[model samples]
Target: MSIWWSIHLRRDAASVPLARRLLLGTMETAGVDPDISYDLSVALSEACANAVEHGGDGDSAEAYRVTAYLDGEKCRIEVADSGPGFRPPSRPLPVRVASVEDEHGRGLFLIQALADHVHIGGKPGLGGTVVSFDKLLKWREDAPLIAV
Candidate 1:
């Protein structure tokens, strides 16, 4: 079975949970293993939070996109934003190690740690960024969606 979804969300704090909840509901209905579903949900939350915090101009000039695809035993997701885009030495051209005492800056790292594969890129100053990732899925024995 192949299932997919996408949502355009404003860079609002409340929008973060809304995206997460929808992803969770989709996974649950598909009978994804609870642990795997939880992991993906957390990753989705982090991605959405990043978008809410840094994906746009300070004003209400930006919104972000999140897309997810579940095919057979793999799940793929992508979060995109229209921002200043990534510039080297500033944005996450290369994900850095956030110190333990740091209150922020771990979102991308968390996404990398949770997913099987991750890719972060954008056209510098061209006004867009994309964080894409995928993971192998584990389904419950009673999963309604047959892994095709």
Candidate 2:
């Protein structure tokens, strides 16, 4: 069985949590485990946040789009925006300095580590950025299996 969903929201931090909840709930119905839920949510939130922060110019009407698909044993998520695309930074981001104690610049890094596959580039023929990730869903041997 395949499940798909799409959302468009104003580019802002407030929309991030809603996106996560929507994606996570959809994924649960598709058999994603709870342990991996946070990882998926974090990766998606970061990608969407990047799209909003970098793509949207703090305009309330600017729209950010998120699409999710579950195909059999794999799940894929894509976040896009109406604003212009950007080339991701090539160098590693500097760690938080002891004196600074900041909590930023870790989004892309977290996505790279969590996702089984990640794609970041300009959407073809479109100006905005599209950040896509795919994860391989794992099944617990002890849990009841459903054959679709």
Candidate 3:
């Protein structure tokens, strides 16, 4: 299997759904289990949404990139944005909100819950923030053969 699949897309609300769909399709093609597909999709969606919402500066539409890698029994996805990376919230995420509720702040927490490993750091090549998550493929004893 190939190590990476990558794309750069506009950082806007409209792009979020497309990004999610692309990630889901990639995972399915890579033979990820159906059981955890939704979880993986949701985590990628939330990660991309965060990058779009809090990414870059000014009114110019920024570009965000997503990269997926399939390595043996694990899959990794990285979402990056060209923005001044802010320190992650110090407190526990607000799982529920009051009458006047904030819809944000739950993304990182949710991503942590859904992924086997989550990492946040500056982008490798350019200057930006990148968030990565890895999912370990659960192999069933009776699983069919996987062609190399």
Candidate 4:
């Protein structure tokens, strides 16, 4: 079975958890393993949090979009924002921070570490940013499984 969903939300902090909760619910209903679902939920939270924090120019009407698709054993998600696009870093992303006290700059790093594949790009003709990622879904050996 294949499942997909898309939602556009105002660029606000509350929208972050809303997006994460929707994704988590969908994965859970699809029989995704708890651990995998948790990891993806956390990653989705980071992605949505980044959108809420950096995805607008103080315009309350601006919005971000989240899309998810589950096909076979893979789950793919895309988060697109309405803010000025940014060029992705050209070097390898660091997995750890230089200082424990640093409170920022870890979203992309966490997303990269959690997702099996990640793509960052500009929304075509929209003058904004899009972050897409995918993960291979795995089930525990003894768990009830849904045929994907």
Candidate 5:
């Protein structure tokens, strides 16, 4: 069985929780493990927050998009923004930060730690940035497969 959903929302703080809640509810209804759901939710929140913070040129018409896909034993999500794309780091991102007092810069680190696979890139036509991640789902043995 497979399931998917996608939504476009204004690039604002409120959209972060809305995205998280929707993802959480979808996972819960699909019988995903609570721990995995929590982890994914946090990662999704970070992604959405980044999009809200950096995803536009102050254009009210611009919006961010969040998409979720559940296929077999895996769940994948994508958060994309309509802002100027950033240059990808030439090397792999560090897993740890040097300072605890740093007020920011931890979102990508957290996302990498929580997700099983992550891909960050610019949208086609240099339109914006996209953060996409996937996690292998771990369902309880008693849980039945959901219909798509």
Candidate 6:
């Protein structure tokens, strides 16, 4: 069985946990390993947090979209928002956000560390950034929705 879901959420701090809880519940019902579920949830939180923080510069978008797919033996997730798309440096150097006192920059790296595969890009017409990632799934022994 395959499971997929997508939701458009308000770009607010409260939306982060709402997305996490939904992901966690889906994983739990699907009998995904708890550890893997936790990892995915954490990644989702970071992605959602990023969307809330940058998805709208308080002028353009008021919401972000999050999508998840559980297919075969792997699970893929994506978070996208309508903002002034992410622009990378010419040389791709690590950037420090705002200042040393500001808590930022580590979220994307943490997502990369947690997920097996990660992709970052922008949606052209939407004028926003898209962060998508995937990881191999580990199932509980008695999982009802075990991937074939």
CA lDDT, every model vs. true structure = 0.83, 0.79, 0.76, 0.85, 0.89, 0.88
Using lDDT, give the best candidate's number: 5
lDDT of 1: 0.83
**Where is the poorest 10-residue window by lDDT in model 3?**
139-148
The true-versus-predicted C-alpha distance at residue 23 of model 3, in Å, is 1.6
Deviation in Å, model 5, residue 77 alpha carbon: 0.3
- Candidates in order, TM-scores: namely 0.87, 0.83, 0.80, 0.91, 0.91, 0.88
Candidate 2 Cα deviation (angstroms), residue 92: 9.7
Tens-place lDDT digits, model 6, residues 1-148: 8999999999989999999999999999999999999999999999999999988888434989999999989999999998788774344335444567867777886787789888888887668899898999999999999998
Query: How far is 107's C-alpha from truth in model 6 (Å)?
Result: 0.5
RMSD of each: 3.0, 3.0, 3.4, 1.9, 1.9, 3.0
lDDT of 3 by residue, 1-148 (tens): 4556888878878888887788777666656677666787898899888888877884446799988776777778899999878665455445554345766677888998899888887765566788899887753344452324
- Superposed by TM-score, candidate 4 places the C-alpha of residue 94 at a distance from the truth, in angstroms, of 2.9
Q: Report model 6's TM-score to 2 decimal places.
A: 0.88
Q: Is candidate 3 or candidate 5 better by lDDT?
A: 5
* Residue-by-residue lDDT tens digits, candidate 2, 23-55: 888766656676666788999999988877887
lDDT of 1 by residue, 46-100 (tens): 9888777878787554679999999899989888888766652343336576678
Residue pairs that clash (backbone atoms under 3 angstroms), model 6 = none
Segments in model 6 whose C-alpha atoms lie over 4 Å from true places: 59-61, 88-102
What residue pairs are clashing in model 1? 1-148
Which pairs of residues collide in candidate 5?
none
Give stretches of model 2 more than 4 Å off: 89-100, 140-148
Comparison by TM-score, 2 against 6, better one: 6
